[model samples]
Target: MKNVITISRQYGSGGREIGKKLADKLGIPFYDNELINLAAKESGFCASVFENAENKATNSLLYSIAMGMNAYGNQELGFTNLSLDDRIYLAQSDVIRKVAQKGPCVIVGRCADYVLKDTPGVINVFIWADIDFRIKRVMESDNLTEAKVIERIQKIDKGRANYYNYHSSEKWGRAENYHLSLRSDFIGIDSCADCIKSYIEYANNK
Candidate 1:
């Protein structure tokens, strides 16, 4: 059976790098922003639209009603009538499902665990780190001041939490929602990847 790994992560925790390295070690495809491009192409929406709506929650009641109508109405007409966020999400969800169906792969962020919840051979992992570690990582990587990095981290994390909580039945960043939750700062990024690979092997054997 294929081993589809979904990694939900905190910003600057090196989750994306870990997922890429893990996929390389496992010889499987890695998907992160690739899903956004695919969703744009598949849905005929601009790539910018997907990027803008990525990990964002739409809380407008009117928008939700419009989205509901679009979901039930004619495809082409309804799609154009739907909100940009709804269109991007539906498109990404479809692409995520198709990607999982293709074979074993590592998918990062974008609520992929929720997208593939019912799919077989899926292992959901969440990666986080100490706030200090995350802030330092982002500051160095993005060439930003500590204050700027902290602000960015908080905003992005809040967006991720809101998006995950709004779209999924489970709470964001909660240990219970994932099969394995790791503190990347404790074990390091490469070690975290190795741990996930080992977990996948163990899970596959079971």
Candidate 2:
């Protein structure tokens, strides 16, 4: 069986970098924003549509309407008539599933854990860091001021939380939602990657 890893992370927590490195070490494909392009291609939507819908949840009323339409009506009339946000989400969800079916890989964000919840040999991880640590990291990496970094982090994390919560039954960044949760600030990015690698190895062995 192939082992797939899904990483949910706080903004500026180095989750993407760690996932890439881990995938490299494990000799597997790493997917992040690349999923957006793939979804765009697969769904025949423009890349900008996917980008706008990325990590964002649709409004509750629209989501309910979309679900009801999907459930009670023909997909061509129902799904095609839905909002762009819902369409993009559905497209991305399909893309995520198709990618997982191909084999083992490291998928960062996009609620991949929720997407593969029932799939065997799937390991979910969540990465977080203290505000201070995240702010410093974002500022350094993006060359932004502390205040701007904080704002950016808050906006992105909020979007992520909303997206995850809207799509799945589990709460975002909660330990119960994932198989493993690590504080990158506490152990450092490289060490966090190492820990995830060890966990994957152990999980595969079992």
Candidate 3:
């Protein structure tokens, strides 16, 4: 495939698994937590730092004001004045851009769709599942009690939503923000990938 596909998904939606399978089928590399390792190498920071800061927003208004200077051709403030989280995000953004430039691949999460928004031949997809389906999936996958599973799912989804909303202009998991939105409960993960492939083909042909 010549085009790249980016998958943004909910916590228990099997997004990573689906992306891997799709990429394997297409003979392309699959990126999920692998993005963290790449960023660590490129940014010279430990991978755990990116893991901890994943999907979190910086609360430093002053830093944003300072970084805003970079937007207006003023690089005078410099990164020393920014917070650790902002610095990490800047590094992560650089890594993401570089990865996209390398080749067509399947990228999972990390606001990749937004990072590569202007890149040619890209398809953005969002995966979501019904509450019952997600809860059951998490329970089976994690071997957690029902109560624990529900709590974990809610908290994780909230974190992802908050992170996406904070980082991007559009709201997370909203239909308008993604080129295609699929419910894993009805479609199944494999079929979801098939549907995405078909959509990509149609998009390219049209």
Which has the greatest lDDT? 1
Give me the displacement of residue 120 in model 2, in angstroms: 1.1
Listed per model in order, the count of residue pairs whose N, CA or C atoms clash below 3 Å is: 0, 0, 0
Please list the residue runs of candidate 2 whose C-alpha ends up more than 4 Å from where it truly belongs after superposition: 56-81
TM-score for candidate 1, residues paired by index: 0.89
Q: What is the per-residue lDDT of model 1 for residues 99-182, given as tens digits with 9 covering 90 to 100?
A: 999999999998899989999899999999999999989988899999899888877887787667655747889998899999
**Which digits, one per residue and each the tens of the lDDT, describe model 2 over residues 1-206?**
54799999999998998899899989999998899999999999999877856444435455455544343233457575556666777889899899999999999998899989999888999999889999998898889999899878877887778777766757898899888999999989999989999998887787
> Clashing residue pairs, candidate 3?
none
TM-score on alpha carbons, each prediction: 0.89, 0.89, 0.87
lDDT of 3 by residue, 10-35 (tens): 87888888888888877888887788
lDDT of 1: 0.84
* Candidate 1 lDDT trough over 10 residues, lowest sum: 54-63
